[model samples]
Target: MYYDGIGTEANEKKGFELMLKVAKSSSLGAIHLKHHAQFNIGRAYFEGYGVEQNNKEAERWWIQAADDGSPNASVLAQTMLGMLYSRPDFLNLKQAFFWHSEACGNGSLESQGILGVMYLQGDGIKQSEASAYECLKEAADRGNVYAQGRLVQLFYNKKLFTKASDLARRVVAYTDVEELARDTGCLAAYITKGIAYACFYLSRCLALGNGLRMDKEEAEKYFKRACELDPVVSHDFHLDVAYGIL
Candidate 1:
C-alpha cells in the first residue's frame, strides 16, 4: 500500500524495507511470498527504487529467488538471469546459456527460442543445427511467431521445403495485404527482415507448388508484397521470376 500511494501516502522506502524484511525472514510457510519478495528486492536494487543501483546486489537477489525453488518464480528469475548474462555490456554467453537452458526446460517459450538461435550460431555452445531445429520446433509448435520465423530459414537451408513453406506462410501472414497496398514505402520500412525473408520463401513455394497446390496468383501477390516491403527481398524474387525459377 505504501509503494504507489495505494490506499496510503506513497513511501517507496517503507515498501522496500518491508519487502527486504519479508525476503530475509519468511519461512517455508511463506515460500511463495518469499521468492516473490526476493525478486522484488532485485528489481528495487536494479532500478534504484529507494536504494542505490547495485547490479551485484540485484543479481544476488535474483539468484536467491531462483534458488528459493518456486516453479513460477524460478522460470522468471532464470529468464531475467539469462537476459542479464547476455547483455552486450557483460557478454557472458556461457552463463546466459545455462540459465536459458533451465528456463527452456521449465517451458519458457522465449527461452526456447533464444537458446535455439544461440545453438544455431554456436553463441556459447557448439553449433548444432539439429539441436536448433528441435528446440525451435517445440516453440514453433506452441505458436511462437519468432520461432516460426527463425525456423523458416533453418528448414529452407536444410531442404526441408515442406516445413519451411509452412513456417514461411505463418511468418508472412503478418503482412496484411490491405495495409501493404495502402501504406507507402515509409510504412513498409517498419516490416522486419524476418517477415520479408519468410515472404520470399512462401512466394516461391506458392509459385512452384513445392509440396502444395500451385497458386500463381497468390504467389505473385506475395512476391509483390515482399518486394514493396523490402527491396532486398525483391532482388531474389526478380531474379527467380526472370529465370523461370518461379
Candidate 2:
C-alpha cells in the first residue's frame, strides 16, 4: 500500500494487492485499508496516476469513503468537489460554498483555510471580511499556520494594525520549539505560526522605531530567527530584512 501511485507512484497494482491481502486477514487493518484504498485511488484517478484522469471516478470513490464515515476522506472529497463546482465552467458558487462549509464543519483545518481564502476573495461566497476572519481564526487557533498567515493578511487588508500586532506577538510567543516539544500534534504548524507572528512584529518595530530602536541589525536578527524556524517565512517580503539582505 505504500507504493500507491498517488503521492509517489511507485507500484499501484502491487500496493493495492498488498492492501487487499492485509485487509482480508484483519478487520482493524481492513478499515484503514479501505480508507487508504478509497482515498488514494480517488486521488490517483483525479490526478491521472496509471489511469486516464477521471474526475467522475475520483468523486465516486470519495463519496463512498465519506459515506462510510471517514472524516479525513469525507472532508477531502467535499473540498475537491467544491473546487470542481466553483470553477467558472461550472459557476456553482452556492454548491462550492456548501461543500466547503460542510468540510469545515467536519473539522478539517484545510477546509477552514480554503474557505477563509474563498471568503476573503469573494469567490464561491460573498465577500465578508468578518466571515473570513472567523474562518481563518478558527484554523489558526487550532495551530494551522496557513490559517494564521491568512489571518494576518486579513487584519492587514482591513487596516486592523493594532489587532494584527497583538496577534503577531501571540504567534511568536506560542510557537517556541521548547514549548512545542512539550506539546504534540502539528509541530510544523506551530513553527509556521511563530514565523508569521515574528515577521509582523518585526515589521511593526521597524516602521515605528519601537523598543528595538529601528536598528537594521536587530531587525535582521529577528528575521533570521523566524526564517530559521520556518522556511516559508522566507517568502515574505520581510525576509530581506531577516536575511540581512536589506
Candidate 3:
C-alpha cells in the first residue's frame, strides 16, 4: 500500500523496508510471499525506489526470485533478466538468450516474441528460419504485436508482399498502442518499436505498390507516422533497403 500509494501514502522507504523484511524472513508463512517480496526488492534496486540504483543488486534479487519463486514471478524475473543482460552496458547475448528461452518455455509472451527475433537474426544462436517461423506464428496468434511485426518482415523478405501488407495493416489497426503495451506487461519500448516497424513496412508497401495500388501520398503519411512513433524506424528502414531486406 505504501509503495505506489495504491491505497495509502506513497512511502517508498517504508515499502522497501517492508519488502526487505519479508524477503529476509525465514518463517514458514513468509516463504510463499518471499519470492514476491524479492521481486519487488529487485525492482526497487533497479529503479532506485528507496536505495541507490544498482543493477548488480537488482540482478542478484531477480536471480533468487527466478530460481525459487512462484511460476508467475519466476517467469517475470526471467524476462527481466533477459532484458537486463541485453543492455549495452551489461550485454551478454548468450545469457540474454538463455533467460528469454527459459521464460518462453514458461509461457512468457514477451520472451516468445523475442526468441523469434533472435532466431531470425542469428543472435547468440544459429539462424533457423523454421524455428523463427514457428515462434513468430505462435506468438502472433496469441496477439503479440512484436511477433506480428517481425512476421511481417519475414514475409516481406520472402517476397510475400501481399501477406506482409495484410499483416502490417492489421498491426497499424491497433490505434491504442500504449494501452496494448501496458496490457501485455512487456517492455513498452519493444511493443512500440514493433509497431513502428510495421508502420515502416506498410509505408514501403504503399509507395512501391508491392501488394496494392501505388499511392505516394498515402505512403508519405504512413512514413511520417512511423517516424513519429520511433524516429529510428526511418534509419533502420534505410539500412534494410540498402541491404535489400525491405
Clashes of each: 0, 1, 0
146-168 in candidate 3: lDDT tens per residue?
A: 89989988998898999999999
Answer with 1 or 2, whichever has the higher TM-score.
Answer: 1
TM-score of each: 0.63, 0.59, 0.93
Lowest-scoring 10 consecutive residues by lDDT in candidate 1?
A: 181-190
Model 1 clashing-pair count: 0
**lDDT at 158 for candidate 2?**
65
Instruction: Give the top-scoring candidate (TM-score).
Output: 3
Q: Write the per-residue lDDT of candidate 1 for residues 1-246, one digit (tens) a residue.
A: 665578999888998998898888857766678877887788788779878898789889989887733467757677677777887876899989988888787777667877888899998899998999898788767655556667886877677789889778777877453364244211223235456667777877787788567899988887777776678757966886699764
Q: Model 2: per-residue lDDT, tens digit, 93-127?
A: 77778777887787766667768878988987789
The per-model lDDT (C-alpha) reads 0.75, 0.64, 0.87
- Give the local distance difference test score of model 1: 0.75
Q: What is the lDDT of residue 96 in candidate 1?
A: 90
lDDT of 2: 0.64
In model 3, how large is the Cα lDDT of residue 75?
Answer: 83
